[model samples]
Target: MVIADLFKKTEITVKNIELGEVETLNELTPEQLQLIEKGLQTVGFELLDDKRKQIVQKIKTIIIEIVQNQSKILQKINPSVYIAESIGRDYKYLTTLFSEVEGTTIEQFFIHQKIEKVKELLVYDEYTLSQIADMMYYSSVQHLSMQFKKITGLTPSHFKELKANKRISINQL
Candidate 1:
């Protein structure tokens, strides 16, 4: 939204500019571009000017969706398929770019995100491990517990007893 606001102050009008998040604007003076860059920096945002970086951000956005929402899309399609379709690229290319930029596979990132969600849900205490596992599409509670411990170095049950979160923000992950 801030990106949109930044563009509004200049001649640039973005119909669709997902790549690099601002890769190809209509037109803007050098002064306008400088002003927009400075504004973004002041607000703790930066223009992602590289296509590879843009892809990485897109992948992160999709994974965050999986972690935060039990959406119909997630249930209806496989993650690789969903991501590939969403971004109009082959999954292999996306995976390679993600690993090169992030130094971790997409699956690992998804697991980390899923574990973080598990921690949040555990703190809420509204659902049992079984329920959380089911909602998250884990084949079984054991599978979810194994992944949770592998990522966080603690079992879900132990994590619950602590009444604290070891999860990081989605952006950090």
Candidate 2:
């Protein structure tokens, strides 16, 4: 909402404020753009103007959206293909670029995001391990348990039993 408020202060109509999306009704002047960009930077949001940076941001946005929403499309499609199609870029190229820029492989980032989602579901206590496994598109409960252990050094059940919720913020993942 900070972003929306910033635009509002500028008398700019913000139609939406999803990750990597900011819609305005009218073209902004260079000065207006500069002011907005400065405001965004002040709040840790960068206006990505470089093509490569834009593509990388899009990839992160798509991955986070899919995992956080528990998207069923992942069950029917490979993540690589989904990202490539979504970004209109080759998977290999995207992976290479992401690794170069983010210092982590795309697959690793995806796994981290999935693990964070699992942590969230576990904390909510609204679903069984089997159900969460299925919802997260894991092949089985054992697979989820193994991955959960590998990433967090704690089994899902153990993590759930902790007094403190062991969940990480999605952005921090």
Candidate 3:
């Protein structure tokens, strides 16, 4: 009876694996390339060819590191300085590369990520709009609202209301 149960468990595990429910590192050689492909697919973005893709990947790493340290770093760091210092590449080169590969300026990409973070903060409802603006380093709540409306076509209040109704995934941004 125990042997039969063990066999059944093994069969079910095999079925799950066959159905793509199980993931393993062996399935993903060249891990960095796999990650880049997956990230683009997740966000409905397209990958450039290998060389351009690598450049974009580096830019993304810079963005991610900055954002992760946003609270500590943003207060003292201007965007240009942040880009230059963190990326170890001249700001002009990085911006030109980002624009060539992404079809958007680096500033535009940064704004998009900021807007996405604002959306997430608004959805949480933990912070007031003013507090969100302050935390995110906007000059004022009005400034935050203006940018939010410009990018999302909704005011912060309206966004929070809609968020109450239906949530949007930040990754999908």
lDDT of each: 0.84, 0.91, 0.69
lDDT of 2 by residue, 33-105 (tens): 9989999999998888777888888998899999999998897899999999999989999999999889999
Pairs that clash in candidate 3: none
TM-score of 1: 0.83
Task: Point out the higher-scoring one by lDDT: 1 or 3.
Answer: 1
Ranking by TM-score: 1, 2, 3
Candidate 1 residue lDDT tens string, 89-126: 99999999999999999999988888889999999889
List the candidates' TM-scores in order: 0.83, 0.80, 0.65
- Minimum summed lDDT over a 10-residue window in model 2 is located at 163-172
RMSD of each: 6.3, 6.1, 11.0
lDDT of 3 at 131: 85
lDDT of 3 at 4: 26
- Please give, for residues 136-168, the per-residue lDDT of candidate 3 as tens digits: 888999998999999999998998897786765
Number of the predicted model whose TM-score against the real structure is largest: 1
